[model samples]
Target chain A: MGWFRKKEKPQEVVTEKKDLWTICPSCKAHVYKDEWDKNFSVCPQCNFHDKINWKERMDILLDPGTFREINDNVSTADPLEFKDSKGSYAEKAEATKVKTGMKEAVITGRGKIHGIRVVMAVMDFRFLGGSLASGTGEKILLASEYALRHKYPYIVVSASGGARMHEGIISLMQMAKTCAGVARLKKMGIPYISILTDPTTGGVSASFATMGDINIAEPKALIGFAGRRVIEETIKQKLPDDFQTAEYVLDHGFIDQIVNRKEMKNFLYKVLRYWKAK
Target chain B: MNLDFEKNAPEIEEKIAELTKQKATDPNAKVDDQIVGLKKELDKVLKEAYAHLTPWQTVQVARHPNRPLLRDYIAGMCGEFIELHGDRCFGDDKGIIGGFATIADSHVMIIGHQKGKNLEDNVKSNFGMATPEGYRKALRLMKLAEKFKIPIITFIDTPGAYPGADAEARGQAEAIARNLTEMSQLEVPVIVVVTGEGGSGGALGIGVGDVILMLSNSVYSVISPEGCASILWRDGSKAPEAAEALKITANSLFKLGIVDEIIPEPIGGAHRDYDGTLQAVKQALLKHLNILRRVSERKLVDRRFEKYCRIGRFKHR
Candidate 1:
């Protein structure tokens, strides 16, 4: 008798209008998340550059599904057993691992950029502020070694605060370790292009991040040897508004060129093509 | 003028000065016995204090105003020294001094972080902090040394590279990176000594070497304990605790396998006995150089690269 006279129609799918937006660091404009992601996290109105996570960074730089990560098993040793008022260094790293879903600050892999095979290491600023630790250094060195053996172009995109202080001297030595790794490629005349993003300072800035055959950076990226506040304190003078910007260093002859995020992949492809012999 | 751990040092020094002044005024002043006794007591005090120096105290000793510097070492060991200056791209950086010199009859390129002995000198050298040009000059000299088939010896004593606007504008990072990359394949034996404050990347700019030596009371840290405390604890007063945790002392660094050998200092520290410290450093240099001289140039470069390559303590799973 209750022959379903009227099955309730499926609820009409409501278009999600939830406010997901990115606040541009420079212009403070709220860009819709989808639009921002589509633009590689760049602001549409002000055209300000925003940092992307490692996954986004990889996807933006590499061919679809072509990345095979190398040295993925490397992890920190907590060499110092460092503990601070915040927490233990080992525990902090573990938490960062869970949060960032990354083993170390840097992720090294082999991938194709515009169908050109290359080995690359890209730093994730989300992971412990992209501080270089033993694991980061090891992964970079191993990747560089792989590139050297294969005679492939090596590229490193650096976005870091500096050395991870928890590892102490080991953290500082990562500079030397990574530089030696890069030097190997340099000695063999391999193309090493260093793409510096915003806020590349301190130990990383003073290491392989700067030692590139072609050093290019993003527009308005803060690239310098020391922190701006540190420089302000030491010099007892206020820095200009554009201090440490990529354009500023370019004017000073520290960097080669500034490439926009959208054009980065194409620019790298061109460089690889230039070095490649058909 | 501030002593971190040696208690009564300033007062004892003042008393010694007073007695010496009195003796000078009155040629027959009977203060010789007192002065000698006080000096003996002072030595005892220094020995006892230095024997138990915490890592923070060692840091202070490393940066002590009167600590013997590269100039003193040059006078003691580098015979027939001629300083080479200028990066040729910019003005000569006074923060680091490099030269061609004979060390025990071997012509080596001697480079070191130079601190001023006086106020004017400090101003000129920027308190031992280097500009980008300083590192560039060092690289220039190391290349020169390689061309001459000579070994390279560098002394690390800076608090750090200058964290200033001009330094950044001038490419401090690139300058240091050049040294790190070029030095690894320079085809010359490189010997490095941490004579004092081994400040972060600044010290490591010229720090790559076949053998790394550190003085007993010297410190090599990624950052000053004060800076660490401020960053981690939001309190600069916790510097002592930070120093302890950082393990910046030579013995600690040696235990961590970062420092190859620790050269012995005097009973107190390097500042207390400059000549003794310099002699010990000279002996260590000669000893290591003799060993390095026997190794082939290719082996030296490869070993140097491998030495730094295997430095980090980490795990791979």
Candidate 2:
């Protein structure tokens, strides 16, 4: 070790080049922060659509001056008191508000779409890890009950990552809860429609999303019960190009149609009229 | 090598392999004719074998990749679809899919499980395993249907609820139990179609209905053959034999009075002729819905409850 010791000569160091971030054409890169507000937080560059909260979606989808949200006071409790790296349910809920600006994962209420009375339940991915925990399950159950009582068509806009991690098994129970509620509605013989937006994955896909009397998907929506990566690992094979996309699902006969956002309301109007006639 | 005798064994396999290869190379290859011929041969063997399928074969058919899933039925049968999200509690589950749509002139609520066609989709949908939230979402949609006075339809195709650590932590068993209790008294005319594998509690989570219809090749069982084997023999390999004991095939279940009716599949299977399978499903659903329309709410609920209770009550004497 002593023999290998050598004197070092001083040398000039070169400065490392910084990465040049380009604005994505679809999702506008760094621009004036205020500019995003005008665009509804959608990327100004490439028109990449950012996830919107349930409230914003309601404002956009429902008829003006016809929305009346229900069960806003309901919240979750630490029944199991699950904890993880994300922190406890209490901490997560507070942080979620700061991050996603929502109180819960879903908002259920009565609303009118083109003057057709409907019960609406929209899930917001921003709150509580976008997971379906007991609170979300209960709210949906309540919404279904409301719809059944009022004889209104039920409409739900879905966007979720899966069951909530904090609530543990209670989150998983919602599958049965929601299914039972839907079963009750089925006995009542009312119309129910599910609009599958982007990234409708996990348990949500397994239960009501696939259960709709009419199942519609947004263009390019990623819809499946399991994630693509998980399936790949299980099957030990590469997936097809389209895989869970709306177009691919349509071709495979999973989705009835893939409608654009602009056409969704009109299409729904027609469906509602048909069902109402009968 | 006796070529003549050897030919029969490999013929179907060879044809399928050839067509698969051609399909890989040529996206537009019209192998439909070849596939049709092979399917006919396969169907003859299947009808002969399936008519006498052990519990395990039924399980395999129920889990077949080519089998028509709930999504497939909805796409083929309904005109428009609008998906609903979230259980309105903690989060939204992907295991269950529900919303509103139209069947001919009638507006209806539709719900079902969506198993993925490939790996990614399967994981996304949790292999069609419902969580508590999924059930809750179904509950939400059901209430909505009741409010609107629209009919409700459910297409069940799940192996079971997720048995993973996370799912158990989230209350899987209790949720399924609740569904069993609550669905019995729902006021709507609930129609359930077991389009594919209906495994245990997961299927039961959404299984209650005034009219329960099962596809020709579909199977509904308390537990999957592998699960049964694991419990009974402590070996997964014994699933074939265990399947024989389960008597889970649609025909067997129909005979046992577990299932209300068995909807016929196209010759061979649903995968061979998706359109034809859709037609059959549509006709069956319409027929059932028509009959259900005349039933009073109280009668429907009572009948549905009684139907499930009547299972496995045969005299032992």
Candidate 3:
């Protein structure tokens, strides 16, 4: 066994060299990839919550091996036969599926967080910019429905640019659809904890992302309905550097807390435990 | 209020303009034949143009300055209307108008985005770009409709919600979000009509309804084609292409099941025939309102919830 481990060092070093560096956007520091992953992708220098895909997010937040995905079978179709300069939405969807290894931008499922069962739907920014389309919205609604039916708490970690432009009005409709889902969950007395990760904007911010009973945002997350450029152009004024950041929103009383990445799971667990005790 | 592509119809529009000038100057230089000929040519050109309008053309038609605005809809369709103002949480927003009115003897609450008809009004109303107060004003009116058990009607026509820093500071996203949650649970028949540019959260802020309808030439999209183009292609001139991809036309929305019905426009589009457009809209609203009124509040809310929930769903193998 010792001789075999020694022989594997050369191959392991090659893999590490290929994947072991990430630049921190905040501090502009080169971070060791392994160290970053070990810290749940939070930059050790500036503590920036580096953008992560849904799978990584789920693994960080959910109890090990406890995620049972719901609405995984539901998918989107090219209903309008939408085509852009790049290609048809169908081709883009296929490409995104291969790139993200997920059927949709959002992954909805039930999972355990510190032994507390909760239904969660985490958005994947890598999948079509984490834009909310019809499928993404439907998955969220289905997740909430599952929570309401089975009496489980709900949590959603949102990271999106906005609504899916390729899906058009079908995407816009998701804003109302997801909100209606959240409303039902609330009516059934289920608690919803919405965690806004880095860059939650557009239609998503204006809907279920902001509809949570307890809206939690990651530190420095960008959360707003309009892009900064759009706002600047509309108002004809320069905005503050910190405008639309999670801290700014928190100062404005829009969100409840700005939880750090490393403590997010424990914080959620504590909240769920409190609800359970009540 | 000419469409941007009207410039391309020189044989029709330019000839008509020139012949009208000729007639005015000569008082009768055999201009009658030319006028009739141009008119016929114009009709043919219009038919061809309207038959296969690109998505961006539909967007232009929806935003045609002469298109009947919210005030026209209220004045023409409502038997009587009492205008309501203010969100109760902030100053009144002229961009959104709400009131109590009767449609075909059925008491209903009418709310809509007001882009304002003239230059002065347009500036005053911010081109129907709603502030957070506007959404809150809508919520207040919706709640009143629920309290009185009156059916609710909303006319969506906005480029988008206002994107000013002040609006954001006041929680524009939160205001729009609250409307979505509250409207879904409101115990009344809610009907939404995409009357013009139903853009993003601005539209969905009051867009959730038991039946989502659209005007024949209206557009409802998550973002303006120009914005989408600029974001995706880094050029606003690519808006025509973006519009095609966005699928914002009422007909496209109907095919996708996002729209419940499409109210036909007059031959030259709604702006050319305000009275005709108003009458058609009134009839459609009354018909849908009658059918929807038969439903109990619980069923209406349930169906409305289920209708939106099922919008983008599909079977994937």
Candidate 4:
């Protein structure tokens, strides 16, 4: 008799009592666990985007079983030992790992995209505010040197908020250091491709994002040096529609091309092939 | 809401309408000829008024909302531009836009300050104020140009590098200094053109060139007039007077031997005649490129260094 009663009340009816649904921060729509997972953490109803962690991005980007990260053991030091609302530099580093599951903001290594040899550097927005600190800058410089030494085409998948605020002046020096390295690579006649992902803003946009041999952006990515709101406030004026979108940038002649996620690997491979032929 | 023009336009229109009605009533009236003569006199007065413009007025012209920008020049002068981003170590800056484009059938690296056309674009470009990363990106692109043996052309138009807490934290001053040093030694012909306002270290960071050109109406100065006024006189209002004293106008700079040539603009201004301004720039670019092509890489670099080093010296009697 009890079994028959349980069968009469379905699992959906049982779950209805539990309220197992969460509203998405971006889209303001209710999302179930299965729906969120299936959509790759993207909102299914409105396509509201979220920042994906480094490891997940690597899995999506690199060839299967081909990502061998270099310099994972290296961590940031408090050369100045600065303090803030969160904690000291060292404490923040530890907290970043627990929160984002990545050791640093940038991960660098040699990887294959459709059997084309390339040195890759990716900025993880999850770790330490996705800012360019001394460690992050060092990682980029090291990656550039690696690409030049190995004679591999350099591909940087950037998604940083801006220059790292905590590391101060040292972080800023990284721009010059990394630029010098890139300069060397150019001297060697190696191709450097920069891929602008979602929310590639601030100091990062001003620098490496604008220095690529071929600059490519993701669809609907926000790419600019300063935030739109900041500029509006400063100028005390209204802005035009479609300002700083990948499409708008393409129209304004700021970016080379806007590529979609699914077709990125093939596009990169084609470019690499052409470069090698040249 | 009553617009500002509503207060003045109606009176002028009423007077004109009244005069026209009177002329229509008499076929042999001389009123029409008299009106035409008065209009000509007004036009002459307007020209006379503009002829003796103050330095502050020139500054206003430099910052004109409709003035030509880097995007405008690139579109008018080059073919198939390719933009590069980021300094790789930090982030990409919207202020200093640098990349590759083909000008006159030769591939060249082009760098310039991009002030957004509107509010949102300005913010996106930090109102054309570059950070350490922006200068670094320029350094990177300049090196790339050197490597490729392609000439580097810089269009300087910036108020200055960002003077914010974040910029300082990012070593804005140091990055600019490094660029100043590195660009001087770059083994390629670097041409700098002042299309608009060329302000201070931000302009100088990417401004080392074998031949520096200025637009007829553009202005280049060590410090902005307002800034200079604020520092020297403790008042921003004195900027116009300071502008004249500083000799920042293209004509002044050319007279001082600070710039090589002044590319003429269309009558009224570059804004009024965009195509004509572009043609002037195109011809000037070709002429300079031709001159630079004859010189060896070693000579180009040496001359660029010498040219910059010789700026701002006073002769002792």
**Cα lDDT computed for each candidate against the true fold:** 0.89, 0.71, 0.89, 0.72
Please write out the lDDT profile of model 2 over residues B1-317, one tens digit for every residue. Answer: 11121225346767888898999899899997888888678667645654554555556656778777767777888899888889887788887998998887778899888899888988889889888788878878887887887788988899887655334334454455446556767778888888888866688778777777888778776556675566445787877755655556777667755568898876556766789999988888788878888988778766765554343222211
- DockQ of the two-chain complex in candidate 4: 0.01
Ordered list by TM-score, greatest first: 1, 3, 2, 4
Residue B285 C-alpha lDDT in model 3: 94
**Candidate 4: regions farther than 4 A off:** A1-26, A29-39, A43-47, A85-87, B1-185, B188-317
Tens-digit per-residue lDDT, A1-278, candidate 3: 57868988999899888688977888988988888889888889988888998888999999999999887887766666777667678898998898778888899999999999999999999998898987898899989999999899999999999888878888888888899999998888899999999889988999999989999999999999888998999889999999999999999999999999888999999888878584
Per-residue CA lDDT of model 1 for B1-317, tens digit only, reads 57757888768878999999999999899999999999998888888888888898888888888889998999988787999999988889999999999888788999989999899999999988999889999999999999999899999999999888888888899888888888888898899999999999999998988889999989999988999999998999999989988889999999999999999898777887888999999999999889999999889889888888888845577
Best by DockQ: 3
Q: Give model 4's share of reference contacts.
A: 0.00
Error of 3 at A90 (Å): 2.2
Off by over 4 Å in 3: A1-22, A276-278, B4-45
Instruction: Report the CA-based lDDT of candidate 3 relative to the real structure.
Output: 0.89
Clashes of each: 0, 142, 0, 25
Q: Write the per-residue lDDT of candidate 2 for residues A35-146, one digit (tens) a residue.
A: 6555554556655555677877787778988999898766665544434333455786767767765556889999888999999999987775456766777778779889
Question: Per-residue alpha-carbon lDDT of model 4 for A1-278, expressed as tens digits?
Answer: 67768776788686784455656776688888676755555677766555676776666667988888886654564443544433466787778778776767898888888887788888888776577666776677678878988899998888987666444334443454455556666767999998888877655664565567888988677766545664576557666656666776666556689876656788888888988574
lDDT of 4 by residue, B120-150 (tens): 9998998888888899899999999989888
Best by TM-score: 1
For candidate 1, the lDDT comes to: 0.89
What is the per-residue lDDT of model 1 for residues A1-278, given as tens digits with 9 covering 90 to 100? 35573343223222233346667787988788889889998888877788888788889999999999998889877888999998899899999899988989999999999899899999999988899989989888999999999998998999999998899999999999999988899889889999999879889999999888899898888888888778888878888989888989899997888999999999999878888567
